[model samples]
Target: MAETLRIALAQINPHVGDIRGNAERIRRARAEAARLGADLLVTPEFSIGGYPPEDLVLKPSFNADAAAAIEALAAETADGGPGVVLGGPWVAEGKRHNGLFVLDGGKIIARRAKHELPNYGVFDEKRVFEPGPAPGPVAFRGFRLGLMICEDWWFPTVSETLAESGAEVLISINGSPFEVGKAQLRIDLAVPRVVETGLGFVFLGQVCGQDELVFEGASFVLNPDRSLAVQMPLFEEAITLTEWTRRDGRLVCTPQKLAPIPSAEEQVYRAMMLGLRDYVNKNRFPGVVLGLSGGIDSAISAAVAADALGPDRVRAVMMPSPYTSRESLEDAAACAELLGIRYETIGIGPAMEAFGAMLAPAFGNRAPDITEENIQSRARGLTLMALSNKFGDMVLTTGNKSEMSVGYATLYGDMCGGYSVLKDIYKTLVFRLCRWRNAHVPAGSLGPAGPVMPERVITKPPSAELKPDQTDQDTLPPYEVLDAILEGLVEGERGVEALVAEGHDRATVLRVWRMLDRAEYKRRQAPPGVKIGPRAFGRDRRYPITNGYTNLIA
Candidate 1:
């Protein structure tokens, strides 16, 4: 008997609703696996319709399309004799199932519905999918294989079931989203599964950025001894084979070390870079452009673009106005210099003044206020849009989740980009990233030593630099306080009373809660960024923008 079992872990990126395209990708991956002489190929969960198709899976015709697509995938495998485990949505007897269609010898020989449908933290699978009764072990080329879906990995029962069912190895499909330390978490979780099941466990996770979520492709296999046998890259797509050995009927997974953790900024930096790269590349864009405010957000965005798509393809435009600070100018200049990007300084001062002059007559009695400040932003937006119009570069917006959740951003001003890069990051995480960059540099990073951001940018009072001496603290609580409350209210699902119980001030907590509730409309209009936390305020944590909601204690 041969000791080696060659299996390809395909970290494929699938676009939603593009069934034909996704099927084609599966076919291509299968062909590549055959070329490499792999015995089996495993793809990510819901690769056919992409992850979290939401209500789309509820459609009967869509599931039919998915079934047809799986037939095509099964037929391809019949020719090369390589078994495949592909994920898609299935409909049977008016119940929808998140199914894994196993194909060998060009036919759907075995199938399994995902047993666990997660209901919390970015998953609403229970609403759409009915639980499967039980699926027997899928036998392929003399091996009894167990199949597990995305959330089933979080539990030991699924693995125990497979072990009890005489499964020799466990192969799981996942659409797991990226977050800090999540790569390590995946491996850590898999260890117990392997040890208890007494079988080699392989994880195949989706890659690429979809809407607000970015899937970090750190696929790996763990031996029955609970040791990491093989590991893949963190943020790039690659299909590689991990060969397992069988000696004296004992399955042995080859030893492989995990990839080193990049700096905090480097981790976030690569995430955005890959997110932008995949979003642009998969969507078929030539390049990207963004407003460079010299602030931490845009500066980091431009730097990411330069690394993802070379400097030649990236354009950074600084749309400055009368209120734009000199420090902003210097920092923007220094950032562009550091990144080696194509920098342009387009003064919006003239346009801003003209717009103010045009509106001065109607605003005679009213003092210049937030409306006037926003006018400056809209003016800069117009200029950037004009430039984007001239050259067909996609504009990337830079706004953190904290500001987006609280209406701290201006529409048609800083919001004038095709995609938002830091939409999931809070202001506190933003500072953490800045410090992370100073400590550890990523591959091809062009930022400076000490800090890519200026000292004033970090330690000085936080401001939008929209108006003179206007600091963020003047209008809102500190980033530390605000982010904590948000995490409790949003992620931890803690109510206002609970927050107060947790030691937050009653008035302050209510004020922050109002800001978050009021800003729902703003978030609805904001561009999507990579989701790094449980509640990203976009597709993950959805609330009605016009609701009159209050959880404040008297």
Candidate 2:
């Protein structure tokens, strides 16, 4: 008996709250599967409401919309064609669940809720919805299948039960967002489940970018011995089918090796590029514009913008004040020229002087301090805002994570941008990225040849050029110390006492904590950007704006 099961993986991307579009996407995938003579097809987790719908899942209207869409998708298989397993929101007994709908013969055959809802590190599944009970096996065409949702596949008890119940294969539908090295880890994690259960395993994934997260779509099928049978490409969408022949009353497959994965920097850069491009293109922005200082942060951001939107679409303005050095001008010009993007220099000295003159009388009693220095930054911000208004271009904010953490950034000044592309990257990582860009231009770097970031920009003392002799280290701790403390305090959620107990100076730890806490208001006001770290200073980690409890500076 020559019997082969043709299963298709629909590596499609879905937008949050766009249920109709997502449902249409699933329909198209089903149609393709039927045409290709596929017996089954699966989409990634939350493909209907989109992965990480975040707070939108709370809205009753959105939930209702998702339910209706799910019914529509289920009704799609009415012709007894290729069966479909797709992600969508399903609520039962007044409780919401991150669910996968298994549709067959024009009706929903079975529903599986994600049991292991991740709560830590960029996940808040606990706050939003209750976890569902462990899933059982799904019967399909003379086979008992062990089906797991995105997070459920991480564990064994649920899948093991399905295997014990005589499951021929294990299938995992995932909306698993791609981080720096998550793809390899996901593959490694899937292998154990496959080998242990002695069953063929398939992982169907979503592709493209949504907000800060990017789905790599590295879908793969694994043999019973924990080896790859087939694999898909990264960061691209495709519908692929794997043929499995049943032998000895169990599914059998051949194993193959996946290609080499990209480096961390390469992954990060590509994610940002895809994220920025999709955000701009999907939102219908004509082009992107940014303020380019001679600093490495702006240099890197501009390069990314150029690479993402193309040099012709990336316009950069060098807004220099009196504090801005000639060397800065030279470097900024060089970097922009290297990228071959449109560059314009706008002098903010006159406007800054005007603002200073206007505020002189009001500030006569107070000593000239950060307030006045901030006036310069605001002046530059106003200029950029005016330019953005005059020409329809989205301004890219160049603030990095370190500055965002400690209120080192100026509000409405450098923060005046539609998106913060590198807001999640730390200062230490910024240096590494500059070096990385020089060594190898990833997908987002504008130039193919040499260093886009000037050596002086990377090697020079970090400065805001706010005053004549202002350096970042003059006010804040070294980047290594700062990043370590931030990781402990923010991501690790360690208290100040615990941080100090871990070989950290109490005073230094306290100082960093205080700075981070006080800067909460500024981060709250900042624009949304791509989140790289586990707990980015965005919706992932929410703290009160009004709080006097400082960890250090009393």
Candidate 3:
């Protein structure tokens, strides 16, 4: 006789180091599952201590705390309401492993370790965990259920092994972070496994933000025929109960409701919002403050701040100098008013004169150079820092990836801030995102109703406004050419010859390459920001600051 199993997939968010809080979260999910009459409650990978604890897992005390939390959760299962398939760190045979625990009747019945350790972009699992042997299915609710971790399902060996060992259904718990189009990629990767093993596939993932990573919980279930049965929403915590019944010796899940998948623009915007919101809230900051230049980059940064933390929580300061145009001041003021946030204007003329006089004693009467331009930027930076200190607000840097890529930004000047909102975005994308934000305000945004950013801000040429007639194109190549060259070099795909062959001027490409290589030290010192692309600065792309090897041809 065949049976039915109601497995509740909990897509939840867990902090990196909060073991006790994570356990509480697990308990809450279990209680909800009990009410839903679920036979089993499945959670994301590392639900006890959070994912990518980084070096925290190496600490003896942290692992001990994680172990204690798991035991406590196991003891709660005595109520006999719903069995739990939990993921956390486990120490066995004198080595640490990414382990999953199966709890039933007030005790941990079995522990399954992950077989594959991923070592690539954004994943350093091999450094912390020792791989376990290929695992078979664990008996749960009168059925042999194959329990696998995040990376195990990415490959074929683990699923194949479990199928050969008499598993009825495949359930994978994941802490997978959001990339541009990762949801479709996950479905594509799972379809083959489901077709080969003739097993129902359940991918239960976490929904949360951790440092530079944001996990969008678009969990889903697929029938053995490679058809989607259940689909959960992304970028949020959701509890989805899926039904499965054995039919003709093959497990098939009952098709349920499917949440609408977010568009590319929506997903990228939400990732930035969630990442910034968590970074500010988890660290316990009152609010955020930023310099509101009339340029496109600062405009977008201010919009994101207002969206993440409510309008009243954001403060915009317009620091204009003698070189600043009247249109810039008006544009900045309009943006602030439109966003319904606090705004103020302070002239940097006094600070500039003071700095110039103080440095005049050295008899530096030479023609004005880039040093003077840097002084204005430093003055604005000092002013922002002072305001941040007085108000207990974090200062948000407004520079984007295009500027950061080419050493175009001043060190300790525009770069002085607690966090950056557009650090990974390029200049070309900056304009596009501003248009997107104006056309549609995101779901949880606290910004204004109509266009928060003035139309002129998006249409005007971008500039630092440190000197008169200083457009970005005057100092560098056009944004279109620059961004294309950057994507090629940063993605590690095209070299100098390849770029030149792709209809790019050899001189322009080589100049951009040299600037990118020389600016590594500056990016190293810049503040952290949300990552919305395939490769970001911090963890995704790591280059030595003092490297002398140049890929550019003479």
Candidate 4:
């Protein structure tokens, strides 16, 4: 019987549906683990096919290919190297499962399926996978290693069952997505399991951007005494070997260096950078182009793109109209210069004039109102789309959550883009991130070290600049109030009376709620962006567009 074990945690990034590519990543990690003299190498959930394969796993061919990859990986373990714990889609007894397989000695030894299938918010695991029954520990090198997949460890029952079944150490493989404050939350959730079972715990999380989801990878270990033994870095790929020894009949993890947790601002910024970088590269877009309007939203959007994809791949265009202020033009050019990206000025005056002339006869003698303003916005959208078609750059939209929440944006205008970096970020947080980026460059940033935008851009009032003397405040309440109300309605899910009791005006709260409901259709068509908070639009928060339930006061 073995008294010691060395386990290597592989924090890797896997592309969804890229079975062979993912297999190669695992093999590479295993080779490193072998060099580190580890007994077993553990990877994240669905490391073979990527997590949330979302309906892609339903196809028979995909499952077959995944199975073939798993078999090939299993066969490679015959060389007396470290055993591998891999997760992927598996079909057994005419049922599909989120399966975790143990590969050693040129064969599959033990197989465990995920029991707790997450079905809320960003996860719909129950829609595609059949939950496995309560799992027991798998024997490895004389130690009974308790294994859980992702959500299984969230509840105490699964860990208790494994403990009752004579499990020694607990390990969980996860594809958990990142949200503000989630890294700490994982530790809070895992500490309880360790306390209940009195077993050391190892958590391995996937690190990569898959669609709108970005897994932060901050995988960690908790000793049997509920002390942190190791913490991997966030938002990057890493491989760390954790040593374990049986002390007093229980496995205990040796202490390792802990990576410092980043502040919330840095976490959100890195999430945006990683999310945009992967979306563009994985989708095979050559680059990104966005309108630099000298506003905080566009300015910060461009800054994030430049930092994420590098300045060379980001193109900034200044589209000026009759209402475009000279200060805006200068600020936009200054921002482009600071980021060192390709910059050009494109005047939309001609397009606006042409649209005006064409629609003049149809509205004979009707004084121009918002229709003229909308035409200007559509003209800019057309210009950006044209550039996108001419070159291969995807249009990056610059609308923040505040504007999108109140329907304050023009759909085909500023909302026109392939992706948004600020979609989940509220207006108030946008200002904070811009300041944060200026002061510190993130670890993997590709942009400049200094400020990415002019200081005035953050201080100046925000505007769409579609009409004369137009500020965002012209149509909406102050951002501080709007953002507070939105936090209550969107994130807190508070009722109107509750918000009013908290000192918000009753009428303003109801007005914001109405605007939020009315904007659902626009949000439905908006592009996917990095999800930084819990209630990001699209999958996280779903509301019926056509609803009759209004919170009316008597």
TM-score of each: 0.89, 0.90, 0.97, 0.99
* CA lDDT scores, all candidates in order: 0.80, 0.82, 0.89, 0.93
Worst 10 residues of 4 by lDDT: 545-554
Candidate 2 local lDDT, residue 213:
70
TM-score sort, best first = 4, 3, 2, 1
Lowest summed-lDDT stretch of 10 residues in model 3?
545-554
lDDT of 1 by residue, 1-554 (tens): 55677888899889888899999888889888888889988999999898868888878888889999999888877676578888998777878899988898889988889887888767788898998865668877777778888788688888888888887788889998888788888998888887787888888898788766789888888888787778887776779877777755545666766656665566677787777777877677777888888777776677667767777778888888777788888888887776667888999888877887898898888987899889888887788778778887888888887787788889988887788678888888877776666555566443333344455555556667778877788888988999999888788878889899989988888888888888888778877777776677766787886786563542
TM-score of 4: 0.99
Residue 78, candidate 1: Cα error in Å is 3.8
Question: Highest TM-score: which candidate?
Answer: 4
* Backbone collisions counted per model: 2, 2, 0, 0
Error at 405, model 2, angstroms: 1.9
For each of the candidates, the C-alpha root-mean-square deviation to the true structure, in angstroms, is: 3.2, 3.1, 1.5, 1.1
Could you tell which candidate, 1 or 2, scores higher by TM-score? 2
RMSD of 1: 3.2
Q: Write the per-residue lDDT of candidate 3 for residues 118-228, one digit (tens) a residue.
A: 898789999999999999999886889998999999999999999999999999999888888999899999999997899989999998878888888899999998999
